[model samples]
Target: MAKTLLIGANSTIAQALQENSDREFICLARSEGNLNLDGDLSELDDVTDINGLVYFPGTINLKPFTMLKEDDFLNDFKVNVLGAAKVVKKVINQLKESEGASVVFISSVAANIGLPFHASIGASKSALEGMARSLAAEYTNAKVCFNVVAPSLTDTSLSTNLLKTDRLVEASKERNPMKEIGDPQKVAKTIDFLLDAHKNWMTGQVIHVDGGMNNLK
Candidate 1:
């Protein structure tokens, strides 16, 4: 019986995971779920015996660097980076208890490649990738595997606006080798694979789930 815990369980990716996952699962969300935001994660006495942990809470804020304010950076950092950290810290013991536990973090291609109007979100995700690597190194002895999946322009509620216009969609499609925007379900499947036993041989790597948006011209 594998016990997996998911944060941001309401998001499309998380919801997809819930629909596809065959293992026993626990979900933490801001509302209407097993756990709420007010639920302090630093104390995880209740959330014990977990084998896999997935942090799904993320943002897809796209705005020019000049338009960004101090608060913009702070808010993005809080949600994308700090929020995940809080939950990870709380579940560290349980994760280590699992010993050969797998931890998955959601990152974006914006973290590495330069994108117009993606300064804030990109910076935060870059930090997230770094954090994953650091933790993977720190908990090596505990056999806790930490890895990140960085997708580009995934078709989710987070990027609904950009995907709505035909012109925008065409332009985005033309830019990728796949010639289409990435499906959230596809990305979720990749994440699911990463969290499985097959991933035991891998860690501290950022696997790209983009539709060639990052690599291809």
Candidate 2:
């Protein structure tokens, strides 16, 4: 059986993926599980195996550049970039052992497009995209594929304040050609497709899961 490690198991996207995927899941979350990239995944010492990995730590504090502090950028990069790197570094051996493994990082469309007050988050996510591409190139010989998913506005508790008001919702919809907020399930399904063994042919790609928000209309 293929074992998949999920870094942010508590996330809505992670939950959706777990429910939709047939692969064996090794869930990891901050404080809730033994796997903490910030610390160590000692439990894996006993398992010695896994097929794929998905890192889904993210933040959605959209604020003006001036108001954003240095810590904001640091925190974003820590969770969005360094956090993923730590987990990947720890389990890289297992990934290599899988002989054909896939790693997915959750990014944001803000990485590609310029959005007001999205400086910190965008910069961090952009780094994640770049990092994934580099890993894909470096680990191709190891039979490990690395990629990123950049989603626009999705309905999650993290962004509930922004998606609450009718005005905010309509404005968000009008910005996208699809005229709708992205569904968490749809995004999860896309992640599922990218992580599938069949997708071994594809790597180093930054897929946009936005509802035509980054481009079109």
The prediction achieving the highest TM-score against the true structure is 2
Each model's lDDT: 0.83, 0.86
Candidate 1 residues lying further than 4 Å off, grouped into runs, are 33-39, 197-199
Clashing residue pairs in candidate 2 are: none
TM-scores of the candidates in the order shown: 0.93, 0.94
Best candidate, lDDT: 2
lDDT against true structure, model 1:
0.83
Q: RMSDs, each prediction?
A: 1.8, 1.6
Question: Clashing pairs in model 1?
Answer: 63-117
